[model samples]
Target: MPPALTSGWSRVLQGERVLGEADSILKFVPYSDCKQGCSGMLYVTNFKLAFLTADRSSYDNTGKRNRSKILGDDDIPLTNIDSIYTVSLSGKRKKMTVDSKMPTTETLEVHCKDMRIVKYGFKFAPKDQNKKFVNTLIHHAFAKKDTLLFAYEYGRSNELKDRELICDCPMFDTIIDWEDELQRCKANKTWRVADVNMSFDMSQSLPRYFVVPTALMNNDIQKAASHFSDRRIPIWCYTHINGNSLLRMSAQDSDTDQPREVSRMLDAVKVASNQRNKPKIVKVEEKCPSCQEVQESFVKLRKICMSDTMQEFSNQDAVWNTSLENTRWLLLVSRCLAACNEVAEEVTGGKRTVVIQERTGWDLSCLVSSVSQVLLDPHYRTLAGFQGLVQKEWVRMGHPFQRYLSLVTVSEADTEQVPIFLLFLDCIWQLLIQYPAAFEFTETYLTTIWDSAYIGLFDTFLFNNDHQRYHFSRNEGKNIKQFKLPSVWKWDFQLGSEDFSFFKNPLYLITHDEELVSSLNELQVLSIQGMFCRSSRNNSFTTSLEQNRNHSQDARPERIDPLKKDLLVPNCSSLSIRLWTQCYLRWQSPAQILSGGTPTQYLQQCVMVEEIAQLHHKLKTLQLRESLFVEFRSKNDLIVSHQPNKSKISELLNSTALSSSFPFSPGPALKEKQFSFTPICSYIRNSSLDYDKYVDDDWTGTL
Candidate 1:
């Protein structure tokens, strides 16, 4: 059991040895008088001994006092010491003569100001040894000086326990456990432990103050108990004593779901990274120029052939290779669909659909197997499918899955499946136009097919639409221009306008000094030129026929002679003149000549004659035309006096002097009247014609 409080104080005052080395001092000074009339008191305790200043003041002293009386320690209490300073005065001071130096020691001063003291109620150490008991006793004896006495604890815990005392001075405030108070203050965010040890003077430095959780007694406590640790601080323990509970509660209530979500997000990133593969270009030579041209010439020809084949199959007159062409329509539709899917996929981010129109001629039955294959693969199954079933009978007519299987079988069996493949592409394109949603889903699949097959065929397809407007060429003997689609056709499809008003509208009229349509496919341009030449030839033939008819009815002898020659010899000269006339007419401005509306036969003949006369005059100015005019002696100048010879006609035909010569071989001519007028008809063999002077002066001198 613990000793009683008064007994502990008495033991300490008796100079009993205490535990541990005494490193600190506890001094008490009293100023006020106790109820028993004490004046002042002083108490001082060291490691080995305790001492006090004796009270010596006289209450009945005379008013006039000498210096010696005043200087006496009369008011000093037994507990109130004037000063308490450490002394190390051991051994006698060494004396030195005039030649030797005296030993000296450095002294440091400490000043205590504002020394107002309040009494404390409980003491952890003994006083009087109760400094308060001695102070009260001394204060009653002296009345000259003021003193103050306060309760304080000093020394280690063992010493303090041994010297326990109950304070007799008036209690000002309860003694607080400073460590616990600091913990509470830290927990409430009201106080922080500050180390007051750092000072400018080396001797004045104090120990560092540390803040920590109350649950943590040592560094190992924080390590052992998770609840007593702080996550934010570098130290393993909480700096403030009261902060342990808050940190523990926070850790206990934290949610664990965040890491899982983060993990899933990371997985998604990894999957995305691993999924991508490098793209490669694949070459497919499916269509040759001849096949492409034939297809173009016969627009929707496959549909016509399918209808014919189906009709023949229905007739059943003969079982002659019925199934061979039976699946042609289906094959074509599949190819069309493939092409459309590929294009749509490229345009959209794998979110386009392919829609095929539901029609009897299309024969979409081939797609069943293909659709099934797509359905089998979980990823691609959702990517592409087929729709548009209007008839109950045809509900399962075109299963894409079945068609896909057929395609695989047919591809292995025959190398000439290109036409069928193209048809499939067409079907795909039609599907894209019809079903936008499905097209979007199958966009990636479509893109893959297009990259493999359709990319190089773009120009060929455009040239097929309007070959006369485009030009094509090959690079390294491979069809490089095959993908060069016409700008006009491309614009039509891209704009989704069949009329192509964007190119033809007056508001958007395009103009140029000389517009060379560079993007035109070569085949298209050649086809256009062929058509123009054919039209011109037909017009010339018709004009010659009309002239022949007109001359037939004339009954005149000269007319009869010409008609007889035309019938008998079929004059080459007549044919050459007719061709030359046509060429001239082609060069004439349509606006100027056609503005007169449709002319009569006679009027047309007159216009032709006049144009020929003007051409002759122009050629003569250029030294290209020769004239042979003569007057007959009589209207019927007696029977063939002078016959026009073949040499004269040959000379006229061989003449190179013509305004514009033909570029082909010339033919023979026939004699006409005695006064013969034969215009020169020589071929213009030059590769290039110089019409620069006729157009612009910039080319004047150069030509």
Candidate 2:
């Protein structure tokens, strides 16, 4: 028979006291040993006492016992007696040489009433067979009511070697179930009701012994409770560590009689679970460029998702064709940006022009395109990627629409318009910082075209629609009322140039008010000069009075007092002289150097020469000028030399006279004496006026 089955017999024999002797009698043996008849054996017998006299030999100086006390026969009464039998034997034998010549020892049996061989075994097999011993012990313990305790010495079972001696010798039985629940509780270091029940009930001796499976002990309290109730076992649930009762019941109790305390305990567990299961909230800091606002706050994810307004705005289908929530979100963003702009404006004032452009939606292709040309540099590419990530994250959260709309509305509604403008300004600033030369080139191109063209167009539109005029009648024509129109000077015409003759003959000098003209001139000069210097120098310069120059025929000519110059060159064609003088100053090397010319100077000079060449060519094409003649006579002797005067003068100077005479003018001639000579006398005399010398010296006699 198996050791487990035999152990059960021992358990019945010992009954309630089985636990006391369990440690000694139940020795586990291996299955392999049982097959070989090498299994361990158990001895059981009725109690018998005996005493008998025996002779002893005296020992001499060795101080050693010559003979030990022999068995003495005596009679003793036995209070209890039980049947003795070989319950079980199983185990293997260790390797050893058998000698047939040596006498084999016989198994001995001693009679002891009230003694029993409840179980006995030897673990002589390989290490793997130890589980069988544990199984036998468990079987024995569970078989009989008196099985209070079970124990295996330190070296018995390899599997149970490190584990604590499992003592099921409880005063009462406790039920537990739910395999995973126990594991969870154990992992969390939590103590549940099963632990309480075992600790409380087992401390008492009412039932003497309790049998529980290790699996049951580890189960969840709730599951254990159901299992226990189904089995109709009285259970006293208690906490693991303190043994405090969570619930208590008798096997016969109705469901209504279930412990109220159990409900409380369950509730407590739920509370703990709720806390453990809760989602965490985190705070985020977002900076909106459009509204220039930084938002630092905490938001619950669920709340943000569930907001009706947000939902409405974010909805794809809406009458407004835009998500109202998105619009509001954008508005909020705009508000933030506006706030930021307010701060910026407070610091920078309205001197700076700001414009902000917000990109929206997942189609980063556009943003990528817009910034692609800009992101040629690795650094700009990195920045763009980072900003793109930020934008993408916002979009993922469904707030992209909100942010975009907020930026737009706030930008638009901005009375000062700083926030809206500042966004673009900052972007430009960033772009310039990232790619200075590229930004500069791009700005130059834009200024060359749009600044003038679009700005002019806007100005025209603004001026034409300056005022909103409406007429009202009181009492049906009893009285007519008129109000000044609303005017918005969108473009400052004062800053425009009259030379841009593409439009109506260039309304030069508009608004006859002298102060206004002066102001306008200053403004126009500033715009032109500022833009020109910036473009040419590739640097920014401040606009101020000190930086301006006075020039009569430059783009912005100095205001001339027409009366003053008329006296000096009365018939010199004042306009022509002024224009010629301006050209001369521009062409002079020293003046050009003083003006800080560069290789570009030659280019500018070439451009001027080209213009003059074109003008000359045009004049020639129109046949505007024909040859004019000037006649001169020698005041020297008229010796009747019939020289063809023109040919003679032409021969005298080799035609240089003809070429130089027409182009030059004679100034007021020096005072000269006239001489009269008789026609009959061929007299030769020196002329007082030296016309040849004068003509030769002064290319233009005006000099």
> Candidate 2 — worst ten consecutive residues by lDDT sum?
464-473
Backbone steric clashes in candidate 2, count: 43
Clashes found in each candidate (C-alpha, N, C closer than 3 A) = 94, 43
Evaluate residue 378 in candidate 2 and report its C-alpha lDDT on the 0 to 100 scale.
Answer: 24
Q: For residues 232-291, what per-residue lDDT tens digits would candidate 2 score against the true structure? A: 122211111111111122132244454653344334333322222211111011233222
lDDT of each: 0.23, 0.22
What's the TM-score of every candidate structure? 0.15, 0.14
Off by over 4 Å in 2: 1-703
Off by over 4 Å in 1: 1-272, 275-417, 429-489, 492-703
The all-Cα superposition gives candidate 2 an RMSD in Å to the true structure of 52.8
TM-score, structure 1 vs. true: 0.15
lDDT of 1 by residue, 1-703 (tens): 1122112222232222322111112222211111112222222222111221122222223221211111121112122221112111242323222223322211101111101121111122332233333233223221121111110111111222212222222111111323443343244242233222122111111112323222333343223223211211111111111121110011111334334323332232223222232111111113112233323322333222222122342443253234323523333333333433342232122221111222111123223223222212122212212211111001111112112111112222321122332333333433322322122222223322322221111221111111111222222244433222211113222221211111111100100001111111222356765353245322532334233332222224654433122221111121121111111111111111221211122122222322223333343344522434322211111011111232332333343122211111111112212322222221211212121112222111221
Report the Cα lDDT for residue 322, model 2.
31
